[model samples]
Target: MPRERHGTPPVGSRPMMSIDGLGDLWDTLFGAQTDPPALLVLITGAVALVVVSTRLPWRIARNAITIAHEGGHALVALLTGRKLHGIRLHSDTSGLTLSAGRPTGPGMILTLLAGYVAPPLVGLAGAWLLGGNRITLLLWVAVALLLAMLVMIRNVFGVVSLLITGALVFAVSWYATPQVQAAFAYAGVWFLLLGGVRPVVELQRLRSRGRMPASDADQLAGLTPFPPLFWVGVFALVNLAALLAGALLLAGPFLTDAGLTL
Candidate 1:
């Protein structure tokens, strides 16, 4: 009897693996999932709120926000034609994004402004995706962004942080059940929306105390006519507005189903 073949398939044979993978990728990117229960949404929001409000958890969670913060700077810098050098994330949850370009221009101003408001803006985008029942898409998009950011991380800590965060997101998007994915996605968006505001508030406090003199708001002040406090107020307003808008998008369906309006 001929030995049984246990090797690779002959050329021109059906490429089932590639076909199946493409199908899976298509579904994962564009599939519409059922909405998570309203209770789950509320619970996630509550958990995110507690995390943001509590100091210890906030310290830990702030790393994620810092990622978004620096990412925002890097993104805007590139968008505005600045040459992005790299990004550094610190253990203290602080981050620095270095870029080279015209020092005093609209591009520079926008890049400086991007850091403080990036989280909430990103949260709003996530909320919109969730509202459309694209939970998996949101998760995968996050993972993709992290992976892209990882390429530009200049410091050991930054690379490690991105790797950890990206791994968590990829694991959930790949291995977790739908319910688990939904929960994780909602909680993360909630955290971003809620967590985004705290840093701006902290910046104001530090600035008022005459600390953090060279902060983003101060840098913006130097380029523009506005004072540092004025820029801080602008950041607060944008973040707060994003929070409100994101909340409405995330909760609107639940409210409508329950015969409510806000």
Candidate 2:
């Protein structure tokens, strides 16, 4: 029998975190309200999502986060002189990835970092590309939603994800102005960073489950445990700084003219 977890929350029946009608009601409730600052609310909401995501009982339910982690392993394998095998994904709580080539210390570590943080940055980029005007934002959001529908019809979640990314762009577009798009962009970077580190906590859960997902390096070269702590700490600090710099680039847009003069 699968061992029960210490503090695992009751798993939700929904495949994804159903926002219910929250997204639809945004313009009416929070959008209509003043001075709590819609952007602050956005930031708060974004942070809350990340926190909630970490607490999720199943990786399948939080596929994006799992993908990010597995992607990191693939990246680390590539850098360390290896190849990706393929992905194993699920609806909310579980995943097991197969990869060829194991990361030699340095490469494996970086790949780990990659999976942790890539998603939110992807969100930020989406926001940036959508542009900040309201009509454009709404239009793009519609486009993404329609595209996501086509993806659903095709029975391809990845395709659905691709089309839905326009929604990320919509996030920045819906904000007060183009000037703050960077903030949203940075916000994505921050989301990625948080997601990446989340697995540290997940590590404990994995230990109890008696499974360690092999990365590209582990598959290709054979399983060797994740490197020692000092290296991991060094890995953490370096990635943290890199992500911060990335966030700055996002935040910088508000401060810089960045070609908006018409």
Candidate 3:
């Protein structure tokens, strides 16, 4: 970790939006380290932990993923002309999004699709930011989104979850060392990228046994020509692609340094 030294420019100097001000801001937020080694360490640690999260029975990690999942549904609902009622987070790492809209239409279809695709989509966006070395921006964006979700959180659990997550993100972005901030950003991205894949698999399993009555995949099946299993496969493929792409973005510089291409 490195610390950046900052001082206000002399009075009557360049405007805040000038190049010097922008550079100063960037340095203040991210420090001056854009080295390959630091990035490799951050990316490697995040990848390893995300891999473990997938295999281990970690309740908290799953819950975090669930919040993102439900938040996705709520966000899409509002975006698609639906009146978002609220979000409910359950203890079993499952969630529900309630909204007011046409029962059958494109809005409903997109809202249903958003949940399964949200985590990865978020991960992909995070990956792009991390790839560009915008660690502070990543944290701020995360905090903003969490705060937005907090407003629509109806249940105690959802409120607590959003508060805790938002506070932690804000705290780190404002106070943590640059290296620690980068590490947290990487971990969040990794979790989003990997956590989205498992639920789709579980959905397919439940669909096979006729246990999932109104799962997103089933809803998608009814809305379109694709079968439930086919939609499940689509979700799986999208998540897998997201995971791979995020990984590549994080590790691409190192690979290029090693004379590798993929």
The models' CA-based lDDT, in order, is: 0.91, 0.43, 0.78
lDDT of 3 at 28: 65
- Candidate 3 local lDDT, 1-262, one digit each (tens): 1110008999899755978888887776565335446465456556746564654545667777788788888888878888877888877788888888677779888888888888888998988888877888889889989988888777898888888889999999999987788777877887788788878878878878889877888878887888888878888999999988988887756876788865
State the lDDT of candidate 1 residue by residue for 77-148, as single tens digits. 899988888899999999999888888889889999999999999999999999899999999999999999
lDDT of 2 by residue, 1-262 (tens): 1110005456774454347666755543223211123354257336735664754422432555554454445444556665555444444434443444433355544554455344444444433332232334433443554353332222245444434555555655565464455355434444554554455445535634656444222232232454434333544565455445544433433433444421
What TM-score quantifies how close candidate 2 is to the native fold? 0.44
Stronger candidate by lDDT (1 vs 2): 1
Deviation of model 1 at 20, angstroms:
4.3
| Candidate that beats the other on TM-score, 1 or 2, i.e. the better one | 1
Q: List the residue pairs that clash in candidate 3.
A: none
RMSD of each: 10.2, 13.4, 9.0
Find the 10 residues in a row with the least total lDDT in model 2. Answer: 28-37
